[model samples]
Target chain A: MSLAVQPIDDSETINPEAVRRDFPIFSGSTQPRRFHYLDHAATTPKPSAVINSISDCYAQCYAPIHRGLYPMAEQATSNYEHARRTLQHFIGAASPDELVFTRSATEAINMVASGWLKPRLERGDVVWVSRMEHHSNYLPWQLVCQEQQAQLRFIELTEDGQLDLDGTPELFAERTKFIAITHVSNVLGTENPVATLCTTAREYGIPVLVDAAQSVSHIELDVAEMCCDFLAFSAHKMFGPTGIGLLYGRQERLAEMAPLQVGGGMVDSVGDGMEESRWAAIPARFEAGSPDMPGAVGFAAAADYLSSLGHERVHRHIVSLTRLAAQRLMRIDGIRLLPHAGLPASGIVSFTHHNMHPHDMAQIAGEAGVAIRAGHHCAQPLLRRLGLTATARASFSVYNDESDIDALIDAIISAQRVFCE
Target chain B: MIAQDLYKETLLEHYRHPKNRCDGPIQDADAVERGANPRCGDEIEIGIFLQDENIRHVQFRGRGCAICIASASMLTEAVAGLSVAGTRILCEQMHDWFGDIEPAAGALLPNGLQALAAVRQHPARQKCVLLSWEALADAIDKAGRE
Candidate 1:
């Protein structure tokens, strides 16, 4: 397939042309338009720096960390820990120990469910989760609630797609034990008022866990400023390699939670005189297996890449592009943008066509070399609440510019002609 | 404008005006089966009526994409009036077609059903085409057991 390399608009704070050069997928294309990747919410394409970091780790410094005494092992171990420190500073964590690496954001939330919430939750307690949570954030709590015989309730969304924060204060009853919510809605791209929700939860003496999977790539995150007890995000969403997720727990909270998995690297000592083995330190204890060494190296590079780009610039690009896309989509006949009540700055726009199915819309877009996600997007509850079975979703990232949205609009119009004409 | 081969005019016509689509569950059906693609949340409830060891009638009800709905519409028309065993064979042949396994030299898919085969290149959409057929297959099995 030939690529259509359109001229980039340099008016934006983050220049898509310069950023696209960093991402190898858009590097060699001279054609006007070949591939318009608008599925950034699903996962971002890795930059050269992140890709090279993973390659360098394996080709030059590959080793099983913490087990080897040799220099290579030490180097791998140092790099892994160095990545942790880099991430700690990236998210504005008070200490590196607050960060625990898991396989995915789903795993991080599961660890919290099984290790932290399970023990403290009583049968009569209630866990309040927002309706906008992706299954990764919702299902874990549902399973834990079912297991513990605890009551699970939802923090409903307003028609405009914002979290119904107005009703939150009264919902935090005495029996409310915890609140888990997302920083942004994966489907609507609505950046929920998490800081306000976190503050409200604190007043009720209930700790909150913020699902930062969508927000981490688009916004600047400071765990201290956010005032959440725990935060979860995935590296893949931020142009890093997959199979690595970060869970940041406040020191006191991490101390109270037991290790989700106990084995090799996470044990302080075992098989001594005592029957019970002492677990390792906070972050180490949570991470039981040999770590994803290359993943950590790549993740650090991704954090550094985003750092260099600056969140302000990234957020501005996303907001401006998303607003533009939404406006253009709205202008098209028979197209209904989800949560038309308000626009989001989070760089995602979901919509449904009156005549065409989302799957068909997405497929037609794909044929035009525009990559947009379709269907429930793993937030079925939110979609159901919006009276939709599925919708076409176009998400933006730092590398995206006006041309991508133009391609998406052309695809949508083409789909309308195909289905409605 | 480039033609969307996947959403051919024929398929879109079938989607716009689905045949044998019931507003609600089919009553007096010999057997019924529900098929769902949880990945995309496409669901189809298909029912079959058997008379003299043949599928006398078939009907489906569901909500899904154009491909899924159109495929279901075409499925009901394709399998109607075929013997129970004949319908099962057709379903198997259709699955093979989608899987890119060429049918036996003499075997060819029915003319209308062949239109849905455009989804073969789009693996994700193949499930949409097959959702109703799988349900029809299970519905037949359910009838046989009874």
Candidate 2:
């Protein structure tokens, strides 16, 4: 029951037992069985603080924000604005004008693709993306590039799963208009050097978009430091409620992009003719329909939760667990893991069994109460580049410790027995 | 454990040594069809050689879970030397069985496929069990059209 993580170096490690207390799913009656969740890359379990914030908002002062003039509506509107500020502060954005609330990170990426890149992209221009992107980041650029008669280029990866950024300056030609890359790969857990990439792209007058959906939970993000023109992440991936995602754009860049949607709170004035309508300022122009008010509150609480548990400790905890898993898994007879052997990676460790299929392995693990992800992980192109159809991935969070890794190894052994023996 | 119940020894035997499984391209097949489960990345290709309006031979090639391979093996065994109509009827029976719908009385699954009834409990893996059957049906249709 003592889920104490071992320290990687002299730095203190996270006490998973204490962390689990904040998440209701792991506490006493909620999970009666010996369940070990290793699917943090999919979505993290919500903490009680986030759950309570959402419920309290609806129970106490639920109202449609930015529309009503009543006291309750004003209070709710104030709370909604406060949530925006919390997220703005969380990512160290220079101003609240930079953030827009959207449906999910996928939608945020689409917004950038359709609104910003589609108009600016000229024929024969190029957009660069790494091979390791989740479909959310890759598909948007593909569609926009196809629409504009522009070319989409892929940044190759080294054999060890790191982005091949060698000769970075040489990679971008005059035709290179933009680059969008992930802060961390959801499958390989490789922490890409987005800051370095952004700095290099800046010299070429190429803007960068960092898909932070996988990194926001495990890594500290500062858009100012990253120098990315745009950033996107989902709150649900970081112990927050679903249906709310944050899109952080530079003030100057956002002013240049057209709004993806129109109507309601996003408009300042309307006329009989279509071109006569005037749009609201910056972030509001991008946010059209009624927002998820309670979701914003819960998102802020989740942001606060991550801030409370400093990113340094969280990063160390996950890296240690993932490294331990990768080492242990490679010791198994037929298991082959992705390289740099997941060391110094964020939190996920994916592998393939020479003799067993990923689905069979995942099913055995699930039956043994060890939850892992097994599939292409929505990164088929990356999987294809790796010459893999699927992989069994065990991802870690603050609430997981070495016992979860043990459970995973045991599940792999069970699968080998069922299929190989 | 659900693992033991679902991956029984007979199913494991079929998975370990699947019948009529070929590698590379089948140059002599009369018809071929491939089925893929996009969610799980399981893929199966069913190839059939027909003679006198009957399936004289059947083979499958692909990578998938134990359930999928075993089901494909059982299907090949059950459809050997059967007419196209018989194979079509067997595919219908399998669809009903995998759907958890009770079949008509005395219309039972043949070739020890009844042992795989445990797969019906898992909705996700049911696709794995049915992938080959669906591909086989398509292959038969392709052969008919030709």
Candidate 3:
């Protein structure tokens, strides 16, 4: 297998055989030693290409972006800006200026919560959010509302793990400032109609923020198409560095919001005296002090890697694996399948055995060298509605194949034997 | 009392064939306590019959990894006739006997119960290994109060 190097969505696309070649660890597995990685929703294993890119950024052209005038600094600055541009195009933004770098999507949402929305959200304002968002997306809004005396309303999720679109229209009102939602559920593998939802929110003149952490890696995303006010996602899910993530807000929205972290680099001028600290431009204004340089560089390489491999293919691969995983998991006793819709699921299949705890199941699976995830998966409110405290989740990715799903299926049966009948 | 080796085999046998995995409807029971391993979401409902602070009978009705249920099985055999104080001491001995924690430790598998010794190496499975016994101890401690 060779590495892919094509652009996004050409009919004569790059084959995954070429892409899978780059992930060396996916091959050569023994019985219990098999690295059955079905936990991509938590974090993806890095590709050698992205790992080398990080090494190169650190070893060769390590310098502060937007700080030094030296050649290495210039290279670092260019690499960092290239990553921003890659994200700009990847998410279908109008300009690179619309993309701002943050440590992770958590920080990005916190930036909006603390810096941008905090000062502006008025008391008694209604902020709507779905019950299905990760804690990172849900908690920040609650904190902001608590601080501002604004009310946080939860838009009900249907039994199928989707917001009731029928009920959703009732949720939007003149007072509904914004609706925060996850583009795809990390736990349920349910893909929300984000673009349509955002479009509907537009009619009511409500700003919508989307948490795309789970969707970005395995989906074809376009911020422009999605019509969101703000889109946030982590880079690590896409085979990039951990601490790097993207926050894509419309240019006008970015201008209206204040920066979260205020420090040296973000200021245009510190004032001659000690009186005032004027802020820099829109993107720079939001980015305070030094940023993760190598992270950004590796993120660019990752963006390049995903684009070259084609996200559409990746999405297809994962969706097919999800179907296979569900079919196999359903065969085992004590597992029930959620009614996932016709659209492509991100990469998660959450099921519980009748007499098995997810963690114990996951641990037994772990002993078999299968890495699956267990818990509320940061969707406790939804889990509570499902009458569950947690679930064992098998998430698929570009690296996963039928064999991996088979491994999981086998591990699950073994767990049943080990724990139950 | 049965040989220690007999108890070990009993533990392994019950581990392979867990007893009373489900408990429902009207039933006579001694003590019942909910055991949850928060780490892995493994929950066990331990039901025991006690007479004179000794385990008169024991049964489990819950979900978890093998070790938890197996340990529950081992627990039933290990402390069936022991007094309350003796039961606690045995639990401590088992915990201590896991490794150098029990210095000058000799041959293991005190029979079917021997598989439990491997459990110490896998920390994640520790909670499963101790779930029933811990719940049993707590249940016995609260049996009179409740």
What is every candidate's C-alpha DockQ against the true complex, given to 2 decimals? 0.56, 0.69, 0.23
Task: Name the candidate, 1 or 2, with the larger TM-score value.
Answer: 2
- Best-matching candidate per lDDT: 2
Model 2 chain A — which ten-residue stretch has the worst lDDT? A1-10
Q: Which pairs of residues collide in candidate 3?
A: A91-A223, A334-A353, A334-A354, A359-B40, B4-B110, B8-B111, B8-B112, B8-B113, B9-B112, B68-B128
- Candidate 3 vs. true structure, TM-score: 0.84
Please provide, for model 2 over A1-421, each residue's C-alpha lDDT reduced to its tens digit, 9 standing for 90 to 100.
0012223344467788888888888866866786899999999999998999999999999999999999999999989998998888888899999999999999999999999999999999999999999999999999999999999988989989899987354467898998999999989989998998898888778899999999999898899999899999999999999889999999999999899999889999998866688899989999999878999999998888887777889988899889999999989999999766547478999999999999899999999999999999999889999988889898899889888989999999988888887
TM-score of chain A of each: 0.95, 0.96, 0.93
Record all residue pairs in model 1 with backbone atoms less than 3 Å apart, i.e. clashing.
A3-A31, A4-A31, A4-A32, A4-A33, A4-A34, A5-A31, A5-A32
Q: A172-276 in candidate 1: lDDT tens per residue?
A: 789998889999888988887788778877887899999999999979898888999999999999999989999999999999998878888999879667688
Output the worst ten-in-a-row residue range by lDDT, candidate 2 chain B: B102-111
Q: In model 1, which regions exceed 4 Å deviation? A: A1-12, A28-33, A272-274, A340-342, B1-3, B23-33, B99-106, B142-146
Order of models, best TM-score first = 2, 1, 3
Estimate the overall C-alpha local distance difference test score of candidate 2. 0.88
Q: Candidate 3: which stretches are off by over 4 Å?
A: A1-14, A27-34, A271-274, A332-334, A341-344, A360-364, A367-369, A416-421, B1-35, B45-62, B80-114, B130-146
Supply candidate 3's per-residue lDDT for A219.
84
Native contact fraction, candidates in order = 0.50, 0.78, 0.31
The order of the candidates by DockQ, greatest first, is 2, 1, 3
Interface RMSD of each: 1.9, 1.9, 8.4
